[model samples]
Target: MDRITLAFWSLVIGLCGATAFFVTGIYGQQATQQQREAKLESGDLVQLVKVIDGDTVVVSKEGQPNATVRLLGIKTLESKHGKDEVAVYGRAAEEALKRLVGDKPLRVLLNTPPRDRHGRTIATLYAGDQDIGLGLISQGHALVYSVYPFASMPVYLQAQTTARANNLGLWGDPEVSAKAEAMINEWARQGS
Candidate 1:
């Protein structure tokens, strides 16, 4: 073949390869997004082996490494901080979670993006017949935290509001007088 003709063909082939790569990359990204969405739609049953805190649990799924699950739509008080003391309600929250799900069977219903940045599974957890997040909020052991896209935000909020009105757990502590204020201050100081 002529030198110019060979050079022209090489350029054309390179452009084609580049286009293929770009197309594949786009398709790959789309496929990954779809897979993530699908995962969010499925629920997995796991054994709750460890209670990390009020809003986090570690579950063991068969044939898979233990998954750290962060409960959706709830925030518990901080149990530990670098230098700060544990928050007032922190122990209570942890205890409540432990009472609810520790060493028990749990169903983890994933939300979009199954895992969070810290490698925790973001899920709505169920223990037996109870929704774990709602149970925590209803008991006043945790607060409803409605960040964007948390699947159970409305239910969690309702549970928390009802708990507050009924003076459940922390809310029922008359000695504190301003129960919510006290809990918030403690949470802020300890940094959950």
Candidate 2:
């Protein structure tokens, strides 16, 4: 190759590497800084504050108040923002999550290693023996995240199959059935 051509290719490769580092903080890897945060120590008990949506929650542990927790292994429909109307099945999904975690008094715990780019704790939540994200998927309120494997993957996949077979929640609603997974893939594709 000519010297000029080689130099140009080198510059382009360097620029792409630099951009990926600053943008996603890792090359060809998806977990953000937040998701890369230190894993919660085993046996730490964190209390649920409230459900943020179908898959996120506000929680606290001892001194840390209102820590954001993202449910591992699943993603739900986007909830309404500001004065905007609820996305199709959004409210129902959120409500379903709330019912699953209602006043029976529940606590959240993380079996995952890190948080998301938003600095939200990535976690697996259970109310007694029930897995929260799996419950959402089974009810058709959520889907397997697919970005990374979680501890309960097989069961979550089974739940998703059952939910799909039954046409529950988002899967059941033709209005969003096509767009829902696309939005999720787009969001992940953009790494936001």
Candidate 3:
């Protein structure tokens, strides 16, 4: 072949190889991401990265990026930017979650559609067989988030009722009780 023809063929082959490599890399990355999501959906245990609050956490598996998880079926008070009593209870709630999840692998039970409006994974975390959300509600460190229906809504509502009636954790303190009660009432109204 002449020099021009040979050079044209060489360049075409190189371009084709480059395109193939690019497409392969893209697909490989997508496969890896899908595998990570599937693992979460399968309720695999992941390491706890951080306890963001009572209702939120950061978690990850060996090869996946950290996922921000919103604990389903419950909500905790704001640990920041709230009234004094609320903030106090919020901080306590955060600590309670830390203790509950300390050094244990969390089993992630993802909700249907998996993510929420804020792009956080909506899941119920379990430390072994113990449901963390139920523990928090039962202890009065969190409240049942009844606006959205979940599998454990009835159990969580009952736990919250018992916690409130017995004056546990945040419910026990008069200063926090009034404020917490108001919030609970609001949630009840919204749910109704």
Candidate 4:
């Protein structure tokens, strides 16, 4: 083949390969979205074994391993830490979560990225008629944490506002306390 013709064909092949890669990427993203929706609609039922804290809960399912769920869109006080000191409102958040979902039938709505690095199921949970995460925020036991994909952002934000205005839970402190926020930031900075 002529030199020019060979170069032209090479360019065409490269373009085709690039196009294929782009199309595959787009399709993969769409498939991921669809899978997340399907999981949410499936309403996976689980039995709450215990409330680890306001934002974390342990649940048991038949034929499946026990999973730790991190309540989506919310950050509650550090109630049960292995090394760190318990932050303000930590005990209250723990008690509130226990009252909401401990030893109850709960439904887990998995997020797009299901399990977090800590092996906790990142999901929006429903216990009976209450949205567990929203309940904690609305009652002033937790704060809206928007770092990840949360089920209902607007509702959770409103709940946080109400809680703050009412001076409930962590909001009651005399001044803005950076304890929990600092701890979370440090954890993230350390890539933990």
Top candidate (TM-score): 3
**TM-score, each model?**
0.65, 0.68, 0.77, 0.66
Candidate 1 per-residue C-alpha lDDT over 17-110 given as tens digits, one digit per residue, 9 for 90 to 100? 9999999998788656544432323467788777787788777777655666788777786876543333556678888888887666777787
- Compared with the true structure, model 1 gives a TM-score of 0.65
- Pairs of residues at least 3 apart in sequence or in different chains that clash in candidate 4: none
Instruction: Give the better candidate number (2 or 4) by TM-score.
Output: 2
lDDT per residue (tens digit) for residues 76-118 in model 3: 9899877677888898989999888889999988898788876
Instruction: Look at candidate 2 and give me any clashing residue pairs.
Output: 34-115, 35-115, 35-116
| lDDT (C-alpha) at residue 83 in model 4 | 39
Misplaced by over 4 Å in model 1 are 1-41, 81-86, 173-192
* Candidate 4 Cα RMSD (Å): 9.9
Candidate 4: tens digits of C-alpha lDDT, residues 11-99: 99999999999999987886564444322223888887777777887776665656767888888777555534345477788888888
lDDT of each: 0.73, 0.72, 0.86, 0.73
Model 2 spans with C-alpha error above 4 angstroms: 1-40, 62-64, 81-86, 181-192
TM-score pick, better of 3 and 4: 3
RMSD of each candidate relative to the true structure:
10.5, 7.3, 10.7, 9.9
Q: Is candidate 2 or candidate 3 better by TM-score?
A: 3
How many clashes in each structure?
A: 0, 3, 0, 0
**Candidate closest to the true structure, highest lDDT:** 3
